[model samples]
Target: MVIEKAKLFENTRERWPATVYVRPSKGVLCFVAEPSLVDVYEAVEGSCAPSGEWTAEDEWTHLANWSFHQALWALAERSAERQLHRNDVTFHMFDERMRFNLSDECWNAERIEYEESPSRFD
Candidate 1:
């Protein structure tokens, strides 16, 4: 899916000040940020609370939580790029998704695409 825009949740902004980029070809959204690994774990864990005791046999119970946690961790560590489909993201901690403010200079998808592409004139 083509990404029309993106926005960081107010809480996310305060936690991880990163630029968001959309990869239209891959149909994924990327967040480029430099947050401590500890912070990433804390933020993701806080957002997704797993019920009951976590064990190898009970791993299924925390699938969604773990999935997001891994993604967040990857983004923070920068060992590998983390990309998520628009449908996979819940936006805020609520059911309703937040609208991206296109006016924000930091989340410019066009500029990112332009920079990533090879210029024929070069």
Candidate 2:
């Protein structure tokens, strides 16, 4: 019973939705405007499922010229679509770039998006 309860909590937390704040850092892999600026965005399940490509027009060069921003986001989109569990990820939010540990899931990257309005409701 105790073990079952623990699993229940885990499931709830995983699905409960959240708004995660990511602090900008050097390894984040995106367009960071300023040293103190933070990026903000929302993601859920498959956040990369928009009409456009993963990278902006100017950033879309070949592998040789591709910046980390393009490479990293491309990797992230693959992970999210396939639900591939990865140890690290780059996220764009508040206009700054940041990263998140994804050893267990692609869910954490999107929790904030899923729960955006929920935070307000709460």
Which residue runs of candidate 1 sit more than 4 Å off their true CA positions?
Answer: 1-33, 47-62, 72-122
Give the true-structure RMSD of model 1.
17.1
Writing each residue's lDDT as its tens digit, candidate 1 over 32-101 gives 4334434554655555435645553232112323434444444333424544332333433211211122
lDDT of 2 by residue, 1-122 (tens): 01122222223233312322223335654322222112212222123335556542211111112222333344443432232221132223211221222123654533343323222112
| Count of steric clashes across candidates, in order | 0, 9
Candidate 2 similarity to native, TM-score = 0.16
**Weakest ten-residue segment in model 2 by summed lDDT:** 57-66
* lDDT scores of the candidates, listed in order: 0.35, 0.27
Candidate 1 similarity to native, TM-score: 0.22
RMSD, every candidate, angstroms? 17.1, 17.4
Alpha-carbon runs more than 4 Å astray in model 2: 1-66, 81-122
TM-score to native of every candidate shown: 0.22, 0.16
